[model samples]
Target: MNKALPVILICLLLFQCDSGKDGLPANSQLLRNTDISLSPDSFSPWVPVTNDGFSLGISQETFLSGNRSLFIENQDSLNVNAALWRQTYDGPMPSEGRRLTLRAHLKGENIELKSTGSNIYISVRMFPVEDSEGTTINRFLSSQNRFRIFGTFDWEPLAVSIPSFPKDVEFITVYLVMGPRTTGKVFFDDITLTVE
Candidate 1:
């Protein structure tokens, strides 16, 4: 029966929520096509990366979802270079001091790490919108080494978290790494980045 309460309720009812693309909430992220289910060869956002002896691509032969997953394969046990897939995102940036985390499903076959110094990690790099020389602001990069996977594993989850960024950050880069001393095939799917 309060007059002010009724006016406030009406104002709230008239306000429209921002429904993001694909009918997701404004804060909900579709998070690129990390699943590797989108178009390939010409327009896919995910890019394949490999050393001289490794091969990379979107494979339909193994996947956790959508019948497709990204793969990095090396047959030579002597090869010591890493094979990875990278995606650059210009999605929204988080506030100062907010944490960012990356999560993904990985399947490794015949995985072997020669050194404990290496890890099957997801690396992240956050770049500021602009760099003002002599300022404290700069790009941030990390591959949380504490999280590692090795020696043949089924479909398992992997996560890497990096510290917050300044207000100038505008885009982020992600990498799913396999090895510098491993011979195997690694599949990546359902990758996601969360800002908290």
Candidate 2:
């Protein structure tokens, strides 16, 4: 059936488009580079970059699900304040009273925390998308949640839930950060954020 061939192709294309390029289900909406094994450049848009201190790389020596995992090390040689990698979502915003949860598999090596502020944590910022481009924005209509991760440990489950938002926020940014006075290495895999 030559006529059925086109229908089959169309169905396949639609199915492929429903899921993410890295095989994430349609319900999972927080991460784009869930599995590092998909591609060397699978971590598109999200760069393993930092402002002042830290080193970022991918490693196969340790991982939770895939053949590769993201590894970050604080260079003790530098006066490090924060060493972090972040993923920002400029897409649709969750509605008010929506419950959001962040989860990840993490392992730390000789990790130390800061004495003053949050030493190591997942920082979540929800803000309004700018209506006008290139405008300096400086306000959070909703609360910010910092899921702190501390100490040295094996691959363990780390998760945090946001109760609900009082306002309609449009943009979300998640960061895997080691705050001031934090050092050593941290490995992360299977990081996810879900809205319910």
Query: Tens digit of lDDT per residue, candidate 1, span 84-194?
Result: 888887755565556667889999997766666545677776665354543344354445466667768889987766555555555777888877766678889999877
lDDT of 1 at 87: 84
Writing each residue's lDDT as its tens digit, candidate 2 over 51-155 gives 566778788888888788887887563454666677777665555456677677788988766454536566566665342353323322211134456677899
What's the lDDT for all of these models? 0.70, 0.65
Candidate 2: lDDT over CA atoms?
Answer: 0.65
Which residue pairs collide, candidate 2? none
Clashes of each: 0, 0
TM-score, model 1 to reference: 0.74
Best by TM-score: 1
Task: Give RMSD to native, each candidate.
Answer: 5.0, 9.2
